[model samples]
Structure formats: C-alpha cells, structure tokens
Target: MNAIEVNVKNGYKVIVDNGIFDKIPEYALTLADYTTVTIVSDSNVAPLYIERLKKGFLRANKRVLTYVIEAGEQSKNLSNYAAILSFLANNDFKRKDLLVALGGGVVGDLTGFVASTYHRGVDFIQVPTTLLAGIDSSVGGKTAVDIKEGKNLVGAFYQPKGVFFDIETLNTLPEKEMINGFGELVKYGILMGGTLWKNLLSDNLSLENCIADSIRYKAEIVEKDEFDNGVRALLNLGHTLAHSVENLSGYTVPHGLAVGYGIRRIAKACKNNGLLQNSEYEQIINVLDKFSLTYIAPFSDNALIRASVKDKKAFADSINIIVINAIGNCSIQKFKLDKLGEFFND
Candidate 1:
C-alpha cells in the first residue's frame, strides 16, 4: 500500500491500495479519533459495500449509521445536503463523529460538504469507489453541491481527515466510468507533464502507478495553493467547460466524458487562437481517441458560453481558463466569457 500525506491547514493522509476497504474502521479510528461514524453512500454503492463496512464497524465496537441517497449527478443538491445535516443532528452526531464518503465523486463531494458545514466542520474520510474520485476529486478538499445555475457553485474547501482508496472497488465500475476517470488522468498528465504524459502515449500504462503519481503530484500542488487562489487554478484544466456541459445537459453527460469534450473544446480553441502548437494539439486528440471518450456536446455554443459565465472561478467578465501551451505544459489564461462564442465559430 502506498500513502500520500497532504499537508494543508488541516493535514490528512491519502492511502492507496487494492483491498483497503476491509480496514476502513481501523483506519477511521486512527485518522478521525471518533467512536461514532456515519457512512454516506449512494443507492448504487451501498448495495455493494455497505454490509461489509457495517460489520467491520460492529466488530470494532463502534456505532455506525448509514445514509444512502439516490445515485447520480442530480442528487447532489441542497435538499439532500439538508437531509444529511438533519440526520446527523437527529442522531446527535457531534463534532467528534466522523463521516465516511463511500462512493464516487458525488458521494464524496456531498458528504464532504455536509461534514464541512455541519457544526462548522467535522472530520470526514473518503473511500472513493470510482476511478474519478480516487485519482482526483477524493484527495482535493473541494466539496460542493450543484445549484440550478451551475454545478458546484455552492461549496467550501473543507479538508478530509483521511482518504482510503482501494483499487479493487474500481474493478466493478462500468466501462464508461473508467473512461470518465481517464479524462481526469489526462488533465493531470497535461498539467504536470513527464512520465504520466509519456505513459499515456504508450500501450503499457500502469493504472496503479498512474493513480498514485497523480495523487502525489496533486497533493504537492494543493499543499502550495489550497484555496484555489493561484496555482491551484491550473487543476481546472477542462473543468470550466465540463461543469457547464454537465449543467446544460441537465447532467445526463457523465463528468468524465464531459471533461473529455471539455478538454477537446478548450484545446481546439487554443490551437485556433495560436495559443497551442499543432503537434501538441494532435497529441491531445490522440490521447482522447485512445480512451474512446470523444463526443460532441449537443448544446448550442451560446448556451455553453452562458453556463460557463456562471462558473465559480469566474471574475468580472473573464474566467481563469487553463490553456495548454504544449503536452505536459499549460498556463492559466483569463478569457472573457463573452468571447467564448468566437472559439466555436473558429
């Protein structure tokens, strides 16, 4: 098992391995310092892993409560967040209690939001089930829920107490989910550059090593800019268009797939504007092709522009857009959302 320690205002550890779910209770006690735990999962996930966790906590002599929300992007909303906070309140879950987010990005995000706000922040643990969470969102303290206007517009930078990633859980994910994760991995490779990017171009990509490296690389960056104030904005590489695509699609588009298109869209625009070189642009398309995640957005360019303006990262008339200068190298560019239509017209 490999573990990466994320040093932030509230320091935490991210442990990655194949079968660590069996040790959730043991690790929770060590990281959270709590006797009570609330394991929040989605309906799609609880049926698969909840029983084992419930039993694990029982054998450890700890009180365990379970909350299962409907599974999907739509469930990450204010109503569900309120219900979870109410659940904790009704159960007398105090600051000392811990929250274990036991699913993909949605569960981790919503649970983290609840943990961050309920009584002004409680310790939360992440047991990421999907490749997306394990590789990216699970480790970052960015917690949020979607509003009608935009995705993740309401949230906080609440750090988790610990993150336990069991690659075995990812084995059961649908192929689409796996591809969704690859999109985020592509983002990391683009941002950090080097071995990860090289591996992506080859046929022999190591999933385990790629997962750990991405987490470690991101941990280092997050440590330097935990608040998304400066360098952290680079992480939003494809997410600006991704969030808008998701919102405009009414979220039928999976985040990873949307991100794939987001990356492509941004890359195309950058190339047209002479911001990204032709060779690097070809490489980006090839990487997307290898993953079989290429898909065109069904929404109008105008709608996409409007949705993007609502992005939380937006300031004044411009948003900080992550642009690729080359493969394994990128920069943050402030672009006017009003001019987004020109990119599409190109």
Candidate 2:
C-alpha cells in the first residue's frame, strides 16, 4: 500500500494509493465511526467494481448505500444532484455519515456536490475509477454540476476525506479514455514541470504508472492550497478553453479531450503573447499530438472566442488564463476575452 497523505487546510489527511480498493475493508475500518456511507457512481463504472467496493465496506462493518446515475457529462445536472440528495435523505444519511464518490470525474463531481450540500456538509471519500478523476478531479475539493448557463456554475470547494486511486481499475478503461486521461497528465506537466513532464516524455513509462504520479502531483498542490485562491488555480492550465469547448460542444466532447484541445490552443496563445517560446510551444504540441488529441477546435474561430467569454474565470471583461511560462512553471494572465480572436485566425 503506497499511501500519500494530503494534509488539506482543515488539517485532515487525504490518503491516496494505488490498488487501495483491495484494502477497502481496511480503509473503511479507519473511518468506522461514521454513521453510514453512500457510495455514488455512474452506470458505466457501477457494473465494473461497485460490488467489490460494497463488499469491502460491508466487511469493515460499515452500513452502505449505493446510488448509480447515468454516465457522461449530460447527467451532471441539477436533477441528478437533487436525486442524490433525495437518496441521502430517504436513506437517513446524517451529517456525520460518509459519501463515497466511486467513479470518474462526473461521479466525483456530482457526489462531492451532494456531500457538500447534504445536511450542510459531510465527510466524503473519492474512489476515482477513471484516469482523469484519479489525476485531477478527485484530489481537489471542487464539486460542481453543469447548469443551463455553463459548466461547474453550481459548485462548491468541498475537499474529500481522502482519495483512493486503484491502478488496477485502469485495466478496464478504454483506449480513448486512457488517451483522454493522459492529456490531463500532460497538463500537470506543462503547468508544474518537474518529473511529471520528464516521465511523460520517457518511452519506458506506462499510462497506469503515469496516472499515479499525476495524482501524487495534484495531491501535493491541493495539500498546500485547498481553496484554489492561489497556486491551486495552476491546475486549470488548459481548463479555460476546455470548459468553453465543453459548453460549446454541449458536452459531447469528454472533459479530458476538451482539455487536450485547450492545451494546444493555450500553447499557441502563449507563444503569440511571447510568454512561451516557439520551440517550447512546439514541444507541448508534439506531446499532445502523440496522444492523438484533436489539438484544433471544431468550431469557427469566432464561435470559440465567443464561448470563451462566458467562462466563469472571466472577470468583468478580462479572462483569467493559467498560461505556461515554461515547461515546468505557470502564471495567471488576464486578457481581454475578445483578444483571443487572433489565435483562431489562420
């Protein structure tokens, strides 16, 4: 059990590990005093490992409940959030109970939102089944659902009790999904630099191993800044355009894919702004290309620029962008949202 303890602002430790699910009973034993646990997942993931997690919790003598919703970004809405809360209410879940988010980013986001609002707040654990969840969503306490207006419009910064990453689960992930997740891993490298980028460039590394390291990197950041008021925003390296793409695509594009596209565009934008050198930008593009990501946006330049203006990061008239200063460092830049038009022009 390789455990990394993430000390969030509240002084609670979030433990992350590979193959932690097999030791679920032991993990649950550590939190046995909680009144009840509601394990929330999506349709796609439930069929894969829900039973094993349930059995593990049962073995630890924890009373467990399960809620399974449809998979995909479309399901992340007010209705699903309400449904999960209603389930918690019907199940007599208390403030002291636990909510286990046991799937990908969608499940984690929805469950975390439900946990944050249910009885004002409750302890929740993240059992991220997808590569994206393990590397990004699960570690941060950012819980949200999409509204008619935009992605993550209705959300809260609620940290999890812990995040458990089971690498074995990746064996079942589709190749496309793995590629999507790899895009996020690459984002971390682009934003933070360090061993992550090096490992991604290394031919010997496997997706599963890279994911564990990405999660570790995210955990380290969240431990230092839980609220995303400062360094945490660095994690949004490609998210500004990514969210815009998601909103424009009506969510047909997966979050990771949209992020992959956003990263490419951002690299271009950075080069245009003279923040990133041409060679560096090309290297970033090359890595994204290796993953088979569609580095180009599907929409027209004007449409993409318009969608970006609606991003929540837009303050007043300028958009806050987390741009890469180099391979390992990032900085936040505020640009007139309209100024992004140049990047789209041929």
Candidate 2 lDDT over 1-346, as tens digits, reads: 4466666664444445556677865675585488577889988899999999888778767798999999888889999999888888888999988888889898999899998889998888888877788888887688999887667889999988777778778879888888788778889878756676777777776665566567677778887788777778778888877888877887778777888988888888778878889988888888888777765667876777677776777777877778777898788777776776764343
lDDT of candidates 1 onward, in order: 0.88, 0.79
Give me the runs in candidate 1 sitting further than 4 Å from their true place: 298-303, 337-345
Q: Which candidate is the best by lDDT?
A: 1
lDDT of 1: 0.88
User: For residue 262, what is the lDDT in candidate 1?
Assistant: 87
How far does residue 164 in candidate 2 sit from its true spot (Å)?
0.8
Pairs with steric clashes in candidate 2: 193-328
Off by over 4 Å in 2: 12-18, 206-209, 342-346
Worst 10 residues of 2 by lDDT: 10-19
Task: Give the per-residue lDDT digits (tens) of candidate 1, residues 255-330.
Answer: 8889999899888988998888998898999998888868788888788878888766778788788888887678
Q: After superposition, how far is residue 201 of candidate 2 from its true place, in Å?
A: 0.4
TM-score of each: 0.92, 0.91
